[model samples]
Target chain A: MNELSTLANRLAEKGKESGNGFPFEVNPIPGEVEVLQIVIEDREELPIFISVSEEQILCMSYLFKQDEIKSGKENEINKAMLIANISMPLSAFSLIDDQYVIYGSLSVNSSLDDITHEIEILSDNILESIEAMREYLN
Target chain B: MSLITKILTALRGGAREVGESIVDKNSIRIFEQEIKDAQGQIDKAKRDLTEVMAKEMQAARKVENIQADIIKHEDYVGKALADNNETLALEIAEKIGVLQAEADIQQKAQASFENHTNRLKGMIKKTTKALADMERQFIMVKTTDSVQKATAAITDNYASGSSKLLTAKESLDRIKEKQADLEDRLSAGEILQDEFDGTDDLDEKMKAAGIIEGDSKAQDILAKLKAKQG
Candidate 1:
């Protein structure tokens, strides 16, 4: 019924047309924005979460769990994250509790192409960081 | 040869050695020429790669076109045989046979060109990678050689003039002596900082921590009110 719902529907339609085969579902959240979850391929059960608002659209993928992040390797993890952030196209790294997430956002004025590109970039950055994190972490 | 001529030759040799140490022109020239040669090679390789790729593309297109022509002719041969013109059909069949032979030859040529192009691509990639590595090494060595030559010139000049330059140890000793004197002067300056003037240390510390004498507009307003009342 709102602008974000319209946008979300269009985004899902575009995904269908694009034939990327990412299983996507949209769920409404109370008083803020609807969430769109995409099952990221090759990431083993960790899904990319999407939230859309009037100001910006955000995509986040929970990359590593607390136990998956090796103990006493915060320094190496931070350094690798910093470099990956620098090299990533449209995605940035963020921390939530003990979870490592690749977060990407764009202004609401962005076209469908831009949103697709940002999501693609975020997914690629997440996949690439997994290898480096393995070496850096225990 | 006369003794004077021999002496002159020795002096020229010594002068050349000095020039070599100062400029090292010969080595620099050699390096420049080598880099130029490498650049020329890469350029030629690039040009050849383009030509080879163009040729491969042409051959591939030729094969595709011939394939289409062969299919069309086979259909025509069928139609001609159905139309009951046996002689014309035989003639068409012969032409088709000739076309198939030409097509087979072109297909072979296409395969050959593809292999040749792939080999050339691999070779160019290797040569380019080697040249890149060589360039990096050359830059490092050239920079190091320049630094070494400059240092040598300075040390040589110092050797002919000062006792400190007699050996590296003496030069280091001289440097240390100067450093010590500079540090002594600095320490004298530092000694003044150690002397304390008597003051209310607690007051200053409290002020620094913003726990004493808050600057507020409330105080100014209160003063203004009292003055107005008076």
Candidate 2:
């Protein structure tokens, strides 16, 4: 538990350095497992919730603004829809042992393509770093 | 030269004879002795007045001395009272009163220095015994210790109990953080909807199963599931 907290603190520091507002909070409920909630800037009031189990990190659900959906172009909204659809599956992949996920949604005004591309690249780098750590540990 | 004139002449002759007898030597001697006796009586009265005057002067001096002593003692009593030594003040005051009473008694007694001195000594002895008793009581009270252990014990208990509560609260804070994390996950949709949906169903199921006592247990099971996954 202490190790997990230290890792979360380091991730928060990195997020702060990248000019992203660190809006993550760790909460634990007795008889329940610990969860990490991250709210991204310019996103709707609904936050992304991640549940950390002994074995996996689970993506429970998401909430979105109806106005944000209606105001954007069909193509833009489609891209956002695709991202939302892939959110759970991607989170599941990142939940596997030694995998770190850096996930946040962009505002409607922002291009999803750019955000998705950045996330993919960042994920690759994070995966590579994790692999390196695994090799070093072994 | 009538008969009445002759009677008057005879009376005058008798008065003249008696006067002649008084003027004789023996009569003169008796007069001198009576004059000496009067002189002795006057001398004795003068001596008695002088002795009485001397005694009055001595009594006045004694009264003045007693007044001075009383004044001095009163000043001491005043100072003791100011210092909050009421027992000592009272002792001094009582001594002064006794001395004053003795002085009054001496004034009424026969004018004898020895008698006055003896009375004064007796008064001094009585006052000294009274003052000693007061001193003994004061000493006893000053030395005895009052119990303050009960007060200290209560204060110690409170301090220890407060410390225990503080430690428990600190530990409780850790569990509180875990509860907050689960709430956040539930809000963020990180957990499957079915899990929480199942929580509501469990509540109903517990009520139906005649397991009212197990309701909390069931809730605990749900919370544990949420917390474990989180």
Candidate 3:
């Protein structure tokens, strides 16, 4: 299997052992470098995707599309997210194509526990981040 | 140009054309090529480092050989002086002087070579580290590019279909709902626990009011004795 798939397996096992009440389901996306979609229980709407590179392990989730924002509030919302980015812990905000994404990255050498912690933190951040930007949504 | 500027330029090129990814595969390919070029340069520097080191060793050997010649000639001068041959001793001393001059030249060359070798080695070491750092950055850029493309594809699919894509507001709403649900569950549990604890208190109150029997163990023993007596 690919690097992401292997990481997904490790994360799945970690979820079982942690018993922090949030369960995980990992699904692999076939490609040149495999991507894994990790759906955390109770936070299924914001599923985190894991993308592995040779040097970085990236965990990201999509927030909303640009068109979903109020028409005139695009620039305003961008500034808001940029302002919120600094205060948000462990994750940052970016616009990929047309969708806004929140992501956290670690070195490829990071342990399974660190990766799992990153995922959990990202999952939590997804909600708070979206809520912070809720005023701009349509 | 700086890496950030290069990346931004590539992204700008892709953005001009609609339907193309902002950081398309071509840009990533270019980045990968750049990383490969950096790797090639580091490899060449390593090769050059070895050549410089080899020259340094040669220069050092030449110095050592010149010093040995001067030492051997000094012995000859001493032997000639011991035979009481003044003319022969003077000639040998002159040869020793030539050897010393040659040794000076070789020693200078060896020191220069040593300095150059050290400088080259330091440059190669620094360049190799920088190349590794660039390669790592390239990988991250490539991964982010690929992730963007994948996310775009998924978003497009969802946009074109009847199934609405989940919005930020909706996600936040769901989170709130889950939190509310958890809160409700916790409160319910607390209520249940309170009732459990309150049951003992209620029973004690009832016994005090004589509405329910209390401490019936002694009464049961007395009844058993009465039955035995009868």
Candidate 4:
């Protein structure tokens, strides 16, 4: 779809802009979707990633492994996760098979500004959740 | 029947009997060779399947690419016709037709590859599953044979006076007793330890300071002893 490619090209341009504080690189995965790896410079972990499809833009990033947490800290961390989930606007915190990851999506109909806003805040959701659980996370 | 024809039929029957005997003798070897040949064919089919899958992917991409080009070109054609550029519009329409035909050919190729790959996949799956079943059955038989031998060996060991089964339980009990003894020593041995604690001894300090005296309980007064002597 032209809309999809136009969106990809726009993202590619955004990825090149200096001092945008949202540095990203385009990774072409053939026949499926276009993936953009966005850097969250302040947080030292895996890069935040976004995927483009014909219908929507998907964003996600991994926070930590679930198994590394001890059972004693589960109750405290779970309480914080619940609160973060309720307070965040578009992103939702989800546990994915021994790893904690946050993810969100926006419709392609949204303007580029709206898409960028969702992506930047999707990463913020992960950072804030991690910072809140600093007592157990760090 | 005539005598010569009957003789010929008898000779033919004898030859058939000899051939049948030879075939019976080598049936197992012949069957094994056939199985090996079938396996080679299956391996070839699997290899060809990967090639077909690759072609399918390329063909599918080719179709999508041309389809996108056609859409773009058609939009241009519409614009040209709106601008009254008859020559450009006709040229663009011709190009669009070419792209459409090419896309159709690629779609056919994609379909052909899909069918070929699916057939090969089914064949390979069937052959692989049969081979796996055969291997499983062989392993089951071999396991049964080994298990019977092991059972016999165990029976013989128990029947003879040489078996260590009786002593194993006694050794376990001995180990438990030793463990219990070690645990008791661990608990009570703390009090019997002769090493002095690192802290200063209050009683020894008091005696050295003359607040208490050697060979005299605190109740025995030094003043009474002095009075008696005087």
Better of 3 and 4 by DockQ: 3
For model 3, state the Cα shift of residue B136 in Å.
3.5
Between candidates 1 and 3, the DockQ winner: 3
What is the C-alpha DockQ of each candidate? 0.01, 0.00, 0.45, 0.01
Candidate that would win on TM-score: 3
Off by over 4 Å in 3: A16-19, A30-33, B12-58, B61-86, B97-112, B115-119, B126-130, B152-164, B196-200, B207-230
- Give stretches of model 2 more than 4 Å off: A1-138, B1-20, B24-27, B106-230
For model 4, what is the alpha-carbon lDDT of residue B176?
49
Measured on C-alpha atoms, candidate 1 has an lDDT of 0.62
Q: How many clashing residue pairs, candidate 4?
A: 0
* CA-based DockQ, model 2: 0.00
Work out candidate 4's RMSD over C-alphas. Answer: 29.3
Clashing pairs in 1: none
Q: Tens digits of per-residue lDDT for model 4 on A1-138? A: 456567767877776679887766544332223345555433323345565543456666656656545568887887778777878889987653344667787775788778777767876666566656656642
Evaluation by TM-score, superior candidate among 3 and 4: 3
Flag regions of model 4 displaced more than 4 Å.
A1-6, A19-21, A29-34, A40-44, A53-55, B1-230
lDDT of 4 at B89: 98
Between candidates 1 and 2, which one is better according to lDDT?
1
Model 4 C-alpha lDDT per residue in residues B1-230, reported as the tens digit of each score: 64336434543453442112212326445545656776887899989999999999999999999999999999999999999999999999999999999999999999999999999999999988876665444433333233223223322333342323323223234434665886788766764453343223766787788886755764477678878999
For model 4, state the Cα shift of residue B3 in Å: 86
* lDDT (Cα, tens digit) per residue for candidate 2, span A1-138: 553354345544443454343333332221123333333332212223333333333332222112223333535544434453354323321211111223333332333234333334433333332232221121
What lDDT score goes with residue B229 in model 1?
A: 100
